[model samples]
Structures are given as C-alpha cells and as structure tokens.
Target chain A: MTITVDRKIYSDKCISNAIYWLSEKYIIERKLDGDIETISVNDDNGENFRTEFLRRLNDFKLREIIETETKDIKTILYAKAFGDFEE
Target chain B: MKKYALLPFNFTQIDGKDVLINELGDMIIAEEGTAQKIVNRTLNDEELYKTLVAKFFISEQLLPPLIDIYAARLRMKKGFMDDKTALHIFVLTLRCNQNCTYCQATSREENAAKCSMSIDDMVNAVKLMFKSPSKHLTMEFQGGEPSLEYELIKTGITKAEEINVAEKRKITYVLCTNCRNLSDELLQLCLKYNVQISTSLDGPDFIHNQNRGKADSYQKTIAGIAKARKILGNDAVAALMTTSELSLNYPKEIVDEYIKQGFNGMFLRALNPYGLASENENWQKYNDRFIAFYKTALDYIIELNKHGTFFREEYATIILRKILTPYTTGFVDLQSPAGIVNSVLIYNYDGYVYASDESRMLAEKGNFTFRLGKISDKYEDIVSGKKVRKISEIWSNEVLAGCSNCVVRVYCGADPVRNHSTQGDMYGFRPTSFFCKKIRQ
Candidate 1:
C-alpha cells in the first residue's frame, strides 16, 4: 500500500505521527521526493488500510493546527500552575 | 465566540459530537463544528459561549478575570505530586499456596527459600517508608501470598507503628492476600492493628477454581473472607478481579458473583505484560475482548445501581469522578504525572526498593529497569537518583507525544513501566498502545 501525502497540506510531524501508529502492524517505508512524501506499507486487502490511515492523518492534521495555535497559551497555563512567577 | 481568545484545550469526537476538555478536566459536549468555530472565532451559541467561558475553555479577554482560579484548579488537579509517595508496598515473600494460571507475582512453592525479606531488611524498609513527606502513608503488604509469611507482615507493621509514634504521620496498613489460608493468628493481628484486607476472587466456583489452579481454592477463599469479615469489619475487606481470557466470556456472571459475595463493587482490572501473564498468545485480541467485557459488566452494574442495588464499577467511578467532580482521584493509574514515584513505591523482599509493584515482577525476570536502590540507601539518593530523573522526563502524559494533545489528557496518565515492558521503550508508540485503547474506551 502506497500513500502519497503533499507536504503543503500536512506537516512532517503530522504525517510521521500518523505513520508511527501503523508501523507496528506494517512494514512501512517512507521516502521524500521534493514536496511530496510517499509512504509504503505491507498491503492489507482493500480500502481498510487507506481509510484508517487517512482518518488518523486527518486527526493529526487537526491536532497540529491546534498545537500551533495554542502552544503559547499552554505554556502560560502550565507555568501559571507550576512556576513561581509573579502574578 | 465574540472577540474571545482560546485557552489551552483539546477535543475528541465522542458519539459523533465534539467533546472538548479543558486543562483542568472540565468538559463541554457541543456540536461537531464547535472546535473549528472556536479556533476561527465564529461560535454563535450563547449558552455554549457562557459554558466555554465558565469552564475555562475560552477567555473573553487576553487573560480571563478568573485566571488565578483557573491556575489554582490546575494546581489542585496535580496535588498528588505535593503528597510525594503515599502508598508504600512491602513485598513480604514470593511463596504461595495456590497456583494461579495468570499469576503476575511470579509466586514460588510455599517452601521457597531465600525469597523472603529478612527481619533486618523489613525494619530498614519500614524506616525508609517514613522518609517520604506524604502526610498520610499506607503500608501495603503483598506477595505470592503475604499471609504465608505472617512474621514479616507483623514485623513490618509493628516497625512502621513504632516509627509513626515519633514521626506523627497518619498511617494505613493493607494486607494483599489470597485468603486461601488466612490463619486465626493473622486475623487476630489484623483485628489488633486495623489492617484492611485486599483479596482476589475471579468469579463463581468453576471460574475461580479454574483460574486459581486448585479445586478447593474457592471454598477456602470464601471461608477465609467470612472469617475476616467476622473479625475485621465488612468494609475492611475488599476483592479485586482480573479479566482473564476465560473470565471475558462471563462478564455478568462475574458481577453477579461479586454481588452474591456481598461485595459492593469490583475492580475490573486487565492483565499486564509481566510474569506468567505475559505468555498471553494474543494481546490485541485479548485487549479488545477485555474492553467489551468491561463495558458489559459496567452496563450491568449501572443497571443494578438504577434498580436500587448499591453496586458500582470501581474503574468507571474513578474515570467519572475525574470528569464530573472538581477533585482528583487517589487511583495511581489515572494520574497525569504518572503514579510511579509520586504516588506509590515498592519495598521488595530482595532488600531493594522498586518504582512500583510491577517493577519488582519485572525484576523477577532479571529486568531491573525500575529498581530504585537498596533498602539501606538514603531516601534522597533513591528517589533523586539519575535513573528516577530519567523516568521523570517522560512520566507525565501532558508531555508525551500522542498524549499531549489528547482530549482525555486531563483524565489520563502515562505509564512508562507499561511502555517499557510492552513496547521496549519508555516513550511508547501510542496509536497501537493497548493502554491507550483500553483507557480511551
């Protein structure tokens, strides 16, 4: 099974994390060619593997967006809770 | 949302609805597009808007007026860290009377020599337990069968009591025994010291005997429980069950057995990858089956609750308490910073200290990854050693890759021991993590 994901649509972190989950069951090989990243895994029968991988990919993409937007607030929140900072 | 800023939060799709959880574990179930709308600042629901603000999910200003309160709640949630290590387990010995098919304790024959903690080691371990700054301390005794080594259990508690007189710390004593042969002398000691008894009972006679590897094991255990209840109060004795491959087939039967035995609830614990239990042929299939078994039992327990039976599923209660209440659960497995050194420590019979009970089981197989130090070592050195520091780096779920942005991160915890045992690494791959799959469900 081959999956080609455009670098413009998803970050490396998202794609890698999505693949990390599937690496346990499949022999996944990842290669980079310019802006396109191709991932190959041991073939499953049909649409199940692609569907599951795409679902996880989409979830990670959403998570990357959330992390990018709220990284600063999260730091501030944790610091406020644990750090000895002046109010 | 009208001119609002997002507070750090995460969401997951549950039952086709976006369930958003804030940093402090406060949750809001809203429409599917709620997360994108919140990020885009296009939320229009007034009720949800008020809820989001009230729950610390969103801020009307750069910093909410109640930011201090929010910070306080966050601090309170991680309050277990302030308590240091509260539950100290003492492994009395590895000797056992009954042979369990899926024994995690790595039990040996009753005559197994050089496996029991020495009297001097017991004294040293008790002394070491008092070093923790936790105000309330629980000294839990476990083994292949702790009751088999009556003298060690007596010495450990007596030593702890002797120290507590001057130390002035609140203390609790627990005996993790099989109840197969809880002798009269042991019951007398338990009665004298107010020791709480924790035992394991798989299910009805057939199931219990099959798992226990003894035909009369169930009878002896039931009789022992009756004697213990007669001596110690009913509330002082509790039973826990592990979902074995055979046990999964009869979830309702298991619950029914617990209720019949007069137990108010049961902990539907899963078998971990340690000791004899690690020989499981297929873990993923077993995990999937266990989850289904857990849900069936939980639903039956809930139905019983609705019908005036005061029974509860202990695991569900812990998870629900995190979601519905404003307090933290004392359960070690569900804590965010991970409960290893922060919540529980094990004093093994080998005169060594371990991070947790499972750590010692791993040691039985020559894996010393979690062995902290010797019983004679200074408390500071044992807890603050380089090994502990390395574990602390990845202890919190808030920092783990897959867990950091998880919707249930506030309620879930990290288990580096499980990670190391199952996945051969402390930084576990989360997507295929059995722990993740089980807890998330």
Candidate 2:
C-alpha cells in the first residue's frame, strides 16, 4: 500500500518517526517528491496498513506540536533540577 | 475560565476517572472531560483549576512561583543517578543442577566445564565496582545457581571485604540462586558476610516441580529456604516467582502458596524475551493473559491485606511507591534512563561487562550488542563507549515519542534491552509493545 501524505501538514521528522515505528511490522519505503511524501508499506500482518499508518502519522504530528510547545519549559524545568547555578 | 499555558502533562482514563500526571509525577484524579476542558482552555471549575496550578500541571503565570522547588523535587526523584552504578551483578557461573523449562539465563549442565568466572576476573570486576562512586554498593551474585560455586562467592566477598577496609563503602551482598544446592559451606559464608538469599518458588508442588523440571524440586527448594532462613535469619531470605503459561492459570493459588509458605510478600514476575523463554512463540497471548493473571493475584493479595494478613504484591508496591510517594524506587527495570549502565552493571562469567542481566542473556544467544566491554577495559571507556552513547539516545521516556504523551510514563520506565530484543530497535514502538501495554494497564 502506497499512501501520499502532504509534507506541509506532516513534517519530515513526523513522517520519519512514524515510519521508524512501523518499520518493525512493515517493510516501509519512503520518498519525498515536492510537497507530497509517498510511503510504500509491505505489511506482514496482512491487515489494512494504510489507516493505521495514517493514524500513527497524525499522532506523531500532534506529538511534534506538543514537543515544540513544551520544549522550552521542559528545558527550564530540567535545568533548574539538575543544573548547578550560583544564585 | 481563563487562558492558561500547559506545563507538560499527560492524561488517561483509569477507573472511570481522568487521571492527570504532571512532569514531576504528581497526579490528580478529576472528573471525566477534565482533560478535554484543560486542553481546550475551558476548565471553569475554580477549585480544580487552583489545584492543577498548585500542582504545577498548568501555569497561570509564566514560570510558577515555586518552579525552583518543583525542579528540586524532580531532581530528588532521580537521586538514584546522583551516585554512579550501585547494583553490580556478578554472573558467578552458568552451571546448574536442575533443568528448568522457562530458564531465561540459559544455564548449562551441573558440570559444564570452564563456564565459571575466574578469580582474576572477579578481582578486576570488584576493582571496577569500587570505581563507581556509589556510597552504598550491592554485589549481587547471579548464576545457574551461584551456590554451586561457593568458593568463588567466598573469594569475591573476601576480596571486597579486604578492599572495603579502606574504601569503607557500605557494601551489601545478594545471592540469586535456585536454592536446590544451599550447602552448609554456602550458608556459613552467607552468615559470615550477611549475604541475602534471593531464590525462586513458582508456586505449590505441582507448579514449582513442573516449572523446575524436577518432581521433588519443590521439596528441595522448601527445605533449602528453611535451612537458609534458620541460619541467615528470616528477614535475610527473599523469594521471587516467575509466572509462566501454566503459572498464569493459578494466580490465586500461587498467592495462597506464597502465604502458605510463610512469605510476607512475593514478586509476580513475568517472563522476559530472553534465551529459552523467548522461544515461546506466543508472546502477545502470554502478555495479555499475564496482565489478567497479575491483576487477579494482586486483588487476592489486597483482600488478604484487608483481612488482616500482611501479604503484599511487590511489583504493585513498586508502582504504588512511584504513584503515591514523593520518592523514587530503586527498582532498575522501572526507571527512566533505562537503568542499564546508569544504575546497574553486569560482570558476566565470560569476563565481559554487559549493561544488565538481560543484556548478558542476549549474549547467550550470540547478540553482544549491549556488552559494554571486557572486564579489563577502562571503566570510563566501558561506561561511555559508542554503544552506551547510542543507548542513551532512547533511554529516557520523557523524550521518547509514545512515552512522552503517556500519563503513566511518569510512573513507568524505559527499557532499551527489552525494546531491542522484542522490537529490533532500541527506541521501541510503544503502540506495538507488550511492555508498554502491560505497564500502562
């Protein structure tokens, strides 16, 4: 199954992460052409891989958003916790 | 309702309540739709809002007033890593007397020649252990049966005792054995050095005997436990159970068996994907059933506690300690940074240093991916080598993809060895991981 996702909607990192996870169960081959990223999956489970792939892709996209929004705060929290500062 | 910024939290539905866990692992059980309201900026309940803010789940003001204090608490939660590795596992030998069906360690026959650790390697491993700056050190002797090599055990401890006269670190010794061969000499050595015995007892006679592949295995083990307890004192002997497919069907019976044996608590350990145990091709099914078995056993134990019996499930206690207490547990499996080389290091019988017990088990099957280095290698090089660097990338649940968004991840752990063995990747796919599923449940 080959699915084309809009690269604008899902960044390369999100797509790659989704592919990395799915690669365990599916032989995934990914290619980027302009704004569209085509993912070809050879699933061993013989199930509908497209829906699950898209769902995981969207999940990674949401995760990317959350990570971006919380990155600075997380850094501040961890630094305050583990870093040595002379205040 | 006021607009408030989120402060790195995750939510999950547990027992019909929305459980929100913050970055520092503080949890709040709120009504259903609470998570949706918080995400959509529509949380109007003034009291709940104030509680969330106070708990550092949401920040009404940029940087909560007690941000430093919150950070300090988080730091304290990870205080296990403050000292270097504390739990040092010495794989004494791979020789065993009994043939167990689900033996994960891949033990050899009783007289398997040249599979034991040499005195030279033991000395070097002890030296490597002292290099770790942990104020308290645990020298855990693991084997097909460490009691089989009583001389090696005595030599290793005697060396540690001699070295500690000046080193003065609080060193604790633990022997992980099958207890079928707890000889008089072994007990005397344990009594001399105060070595704690951790043995296996799957269930009653039928289950234990079948799992051990010896009909009188249960009797021998029971007798061994009694002898060890009599010599080392009752508190010094601890027993753990491995829940195989057969053991799963008898959860209540197993709990009852432990209570019958006069044990106050027991760890309902699931089978790890390693060695002969990994050959069981029905991991998914086993995992599902194991969860059910665990819950049933835990409920029964809780009932016993309610009925004035002091029996507790050790695994649930570890999770509860993380959920209910402000302090972190010393359980290596359930820690962020994966606990591999961070909290424990394995000195295998083959004169190599591996990441953990499972890492060495992987070596038994010809996978040396987690083998840090030889015992003779520099401590700095072994701990900070290329492989360790690669493992570090995915050892933290806070940064992992699926784990970052999990409400239970704060209470759970990151397992790279299990991930690598089961998923073929150090950074495991939690959506497809049985470990993630079981822990989340």
Index of the highest-DockQ prediction: 1
Q: Clashes in model 1: which pairs?
A: B1-B43
Q: Pick the candidate with the highest TM-score.
A: 1
Model 1, stretches more than 4 Å misplaced?
A1-9, A24-55, A85-87
TM-score of the second chain in each model? 0.99, 0.97
Model 1, global lDDT = 0.89
Question: What are the lDDT scores of the predictions, listed in order?
Answer: 0.89, 0.88
Docking class of 1: medium
Interface RMSD of each: 1.9, 2.9
**Model 1 over residues B1-441: C-alpha lDDT tens digits?**
468877877887878898888888888888887887888778889999998988988888877888788888888888787777999999999999989999998999989899999999999999999999999999999998999999998888888888888999989899998898788999999999999999999999889999999999999999989999999989999999987899999999999999999999999999989999998899989999998998899999999999999998889889999999878888898787889988999999899999988899999999999999999999999999999999999998878988876778888999999999999999898888999988788
TM-score of 1: 0.95
**Shift of residue B25 alpha carbon in model 1, Å:** 1.3
Cα lDDT for residue B400, candidate 2? 95
Distance (Å) between predicted and true CA of B268, model 1? 0.8
